[model samples]
Target: MKAMLEGLEYAPEDNAAATTAATAETVGYAFSSDHLRALERDGYVVVDDLISQDVARAAAASARAMYDRGVMQNLRQEGRDDDVAVLATSSLPAGDEFAGLRPCVEALLRVPDDLRRVVARVDDDALGADVVSKVRACRAPDRLMLARYGSESCRYVPHLDNDPSDDANDAGSPGLRPSDRVFTLIAYLNPDWDATRGGRFRAYRPGVAADAASPSDFVDIDPILGRVVVFDAAKLLHEVRPSFHDRYAVTVWTRGAELLPA
Candidate 1:
């Protein structure tokens, strides 16, 4: 497990204790069971109110400030006042800009621990325990913070996180095997998003009518504030729809190391 903590600068000893405490105290037994079932059947589940409103608002503000500053820097570089220049492009902020929002990031990373405890409480290994055990065996967890601004159009095309062609037997390949990508966590920050204002998270299950190798077989997920969506990253094809209003969120992938077998 020491290797699992490598390269993560924020993996402090106290943080580990806090994570364990949080997992025990805050994890929802009923919701975890239902969410695990949803992932197994439809490939995705929306966990409502995972974060409190105050925390979500702070995260949204941080993302907006960081994005706005980045866009301004790009504008200065281009020497243009045209709103079109800013509207047509997107930029990445320095990692430090998001450090304040680390709590949200940690919540996503610890899903395995939460699920494990939940399974213990329920005395079920059918789905939830199986998912957590597979995640633990693999041991490769990755995290990323993504921010999108008004009119910037950071819209992602429909796609699968893992290559559909790859399987467990073909281990040393370029892309992920089915077991590697156990979860895809997206924490939404926008509170007022409606049908008219887009940027919903969309997912598609296998064998669906419109199912291409791509994420075109879409199911729309509203970008509700304090909401977290977790899904089977390999099997669930999903995408971020274009936003009429500004939108931002942290997207993370939790993978297992056994799939890599390095």
Candidate 2:
């Protein structure tokens, strides 16, 4: 696991805990202890001023341009015609408009040791030695998608990024077998987002049934510029509130140990 995070195929026998001891810098936002603590306790955290507003605006324009040009398709759900995205894990061309979004993207791709430790300590007992090792071993994310939910009363129904039942078994022995997402990082691109716009990312607290979740069990965050939301991909039940205006964002899906560090 340690070797995997270090961009290696293998390593000599040693404590996996020792692998992530090396430090990684955060370019988009300072990952303070408070931020990490919030994630450990709440299963999610929202970051403000995540990236420069200028960059976020540029990204939004580029994403919308691409979507308008037909590079993106409608989100694969029934009746959500306006909601669209580039869902593939394809590489962004060098010097493309999306380049400025890289800092926040890379900051998340390079998983921090502190974050690994926090996730390892989650009360879910299924995060046994094996699953915890993958959490510690994972150092990179595998998918980055640019998305837009257009105004037309568009809303995404509740869904989990990864199935909780598959978490313990998501990482197979020795190399990338089949992979499931472990975390989701969404960086909003709209700078002048109005609170009255109505598109908020609402995620329920851990353990609440999505179908039966009460208003008191969730937190709703505005999709504003430089705002980034990250959370446990499998455990948190989340949905997109009805959007009154076009909503654009860059989304990163962390595939634990599925992608060896590059």
Per-residue accuracy of model 2 over 1-262 as CA lDDT, tens digit each: 1221122222211212243343223342245546655665677888775566776777777676666656667746553444444332324433454355445454445444445656645654533454355456554444467777878877887767666454444554432222356667788988689978888898888888877878899999999987888777766778888998988888776655534533
Clashing pairs in 2: none
Question: How many Å off is the CA of 34 in candidate 1?
Answer: 1.4
Residue 49 lDDT in candidate 2 = 52
Model 1, global lDDT: 0.58
**Model 1 steric clash total:** 4
- What is the lDDT of every predicted structure here? 0.58, 0.61
Model 2: residues with Cα > 4 Å off, grouped in runs: 1-29, 78-90, 94-99, 111-135, 164-179, 258-262
Question: Please, what's the RMSD in Å of model 2?
Answer: 8.0
Cα error, candidate 1, residue 83 (Å): 17
